[model samples]
Target chain A: MNQRSQAVRDLLEAVRAKGFDPGPDGPPPDRCWHEAQVEVGDPAQYPSVQESQES
Target chain B: MQVGELIARMEYEYGYRFQQGDVLLIGVNDQGMGGPQAVLPIEQATVEQQVQGIHEEVLPMVHRDYRNLIMVRYEEFDYHETNGFHDQFTASLDDHPGGFEVVAQYKVDQNRQLYQGYMDQQWASPGLRWTMPGKLPDVSAQMRELGYKEPASSEAEYLRSFQPHPEPGFQPLDQEQEVSHLNRLAPRVSVEVARHALATTASTESIEQQAKARQTLGHLVAYDEDARDAVAYDASISPAKKDALVETYRQAPAKQRPALAAAAGAAWMMSGGGLKAGRAIMAHAYQSTRPSDRALVTAAEVATTRAHMRPEEIQEAFGKEIGTDLEAAEAAHQEWERLYSSTTTQTETETVVETETVEEPDQMQLALEHQMNQPPAPVASSGPEVD
Candidate 1:
């Protein structure tokens, strides 16, 4: 019933182990708001191509 | 955190003003990392840009690889405390799986109210627990796992969850139950009848019958009343019930709805027993989800309204012979014509009979005329004397 797949559960566990609180009690701290999903790939791999095209 | 402060923060972070109608994309990945990824002026963005920004860039970030792109038209962004401060914005979530779950909150002009996205899953209300179980049964458990305290169920809630139907016999419905019935039956009832039921308190029908009718009608038309009698409609009944009804109506067999709608419409009309009840009934029938039935009901409603004819009259004229909407409408018109013609013909026949009776000479006048034509009366008297 929990739509969260095993991958999501594992990610949450990893985030928790890394000292990132998922705020099971209430909302996470302001610092935690937009960091729930960390980027796994390198940003350099997908650089600002749109910006380069514009330039 | 007021509206002004939130807007300023958004502008500072995004380096763009999310003015009314500005398009923004918010992504939610498996790890739940999501924010406004791109902001573009709706006027400047093409269909392609919107699709890519939402589908390609944002949707992939959702918990599943599936695209659940949320689009917001920057209406008003604010901050509010609902157990915690929220940075909320009011916007249309384009093509949301749930049709138009918009949360447009306002207080004074520029008050601070945290922006909670339009989705109910994002809200912190305890009522959400009650509603979510019916929609996403696992959602409440997930929320509990996230450490939010689930509110204890109240006595009212316990009763509602375990409310038993009366044993076969009729029982009157209280206002709360009436509201429940109205919501449950919305999609199955005529929109006109449902609207009438909710808007007015002048019905002569029993409360139980009223509740059932309201429920059936409400179920048919997807009518939800925000305020009923004196109580807040939302507070009286669980949104879960309404959501379930809506979902059921959506998933119901499409082919059978028109037939059910026609039946419900007829029942409401009979209950009302008014001269133009058929019009209301047919109008409600016209709300059928199927296009063929909808068009037919519309034509029938028009014909009924125009000629003051009932469905019975149409049936009598056509005798199950009607097929298309045009034919039903034509039948109604022709039925009226036949009625009018028959009345006129009877009136003309009566007038002719009366005129002939009046113009024919009296008995005395006939005798006098006969005498004048033949020396008849005097000759009879003299012949009698001679004999």
Candidate 2:
């Protein structure tokens, strides 16, 4: 699957695991979801969008 | 007199039993206004006797549903035949028009006598009571194996440490699984949590300003206390809890503080994951039985159930689950009005949370029974107008 699909899956999995509904039961995730998809992508392409740097 | 005769006399003066007529010591009546004198013909000459009888009667009846109507008074007003209809509908505090006191227990009164169609004991705190028809029984057994003991309190307390143990029938995820699943994140999804985490980090950044700015290249979020104040919301984090966190950070030896903050920040950035994951787990936890979506569905069910009720009626039904916060009470009241809108005065708000426990069938044996079963509805679209 593409990275976007994977990220959504991770979130879905997390939500599934949590037994809590996290996604758009209300508003469409659209852009936010697209970004989450990118984050969940393969490590090489996504790298760590999570920076170690802190302010 | 003989020594035995003197001893007998002393014993007679000291020894006494609490006979029926013996005056009992009691707390003095603090009520400035004495209880109403018995208008009904009665032999009990004293008000104390009446109060004692009333107290005796009320105290013995085991508290049934936290509140009760103690008295109901009837008022008669003859319509004067003078001028055309005079308006007397409006009631003011100054006018003590004889009406029912509707005396509930003291604790019940303290909660403002709010009732919800469900949740009986919410006066103390906001409560969540749901019956999950899904979660497997073995999960509880496994927790027992892992020494997960539930607190001897409410059912929700049992949920404190939910380490679901079992050789999950579902296959474990692999590296490919990780890559495949990461595809679905909605960007800026949990910025709220991320922002909160970062905001806290910003306060403690001891590094140089430029370096700190470079290190944290995210949104420079500011506190909107003014807006919060405008809303008249007085929700301040208790200093004690924040101090505890700061202490935990400080105590973790010199070099570890940076790493701790980074971890905390990372955890914050992905906080949306936590909410999402939490909801999913809660759903799956009840999946086999409840077969539904997220917690919002449950909350919506509550909201919809109370939609038509008058504020007082709604409180009467599920007031126990609604906490003391005026905002919370108002929100609950609004939830009742929003979904259950009705012109007619609703006597009751019908809140029906299915209480049946639908035990999941034995997984090992049922594998073959429904192999070609229908696929479950996709999560994204199941909710009302997901887009």
Best by TM-score: 1
Instruction: Write down the TM-score of every candidate.
Output: 0.18, 0.15
Expressed as tens digits, the lDDT of each residue in B1-387 for candidate 2 is 221111111111111111111111111011211111101111222334433332322221112111212111111111222211111211111142332122211111111121111123655653322222121112234333533332223212322222232322112123353223222212221222222223323343323321222122111111121111111100111122122222222222222233222222112112111122222223322222211222222322222211211112212222122112323323333332332233212222221111011122212212332253421111110101000
Misplaced by over 4 Å in model 2 are A1-55, B1-174, B177-361, B364-387
CA displacement after TM-score superposition, residue B31 of candidate 2 (Å) = 33
Instruction: Give the worst 10-residue stretch by lDDT in candidate 2 chain B.
Output: B378-387
CA lDDT, candidate 2, residue A14: 39
Q: What's the C-alpha lDDT at position B83 in model 2?
A: 11
lDDT of 1 at B241: 22
Deviation in Å, model 1, residue B26 alpha carbon: 6.2
Runs in model 1 lying further than 4 Å from the true structure:
A1-55, B1-192, B195-215, B218-244, B247-289, B292-387
Q: For model 1, how does the per-residue alpha-carbon lDDT over B1-387 read when each residue is reduced to its tens digit?
A: 122222223232232223453454433222322322334444444444444344332333332331322333444333332411112221324444423222222121112222323325555643211111111112235334533334323212311221112231222223575346444432213232332333221231344433343343333333322111001111012222222222222222433333333433332221211112233234434655544334333323222222323323333222221111222222332332332233334543553354345442322333453445431111000000000
* Index of the highest-lDDT prediction: 1
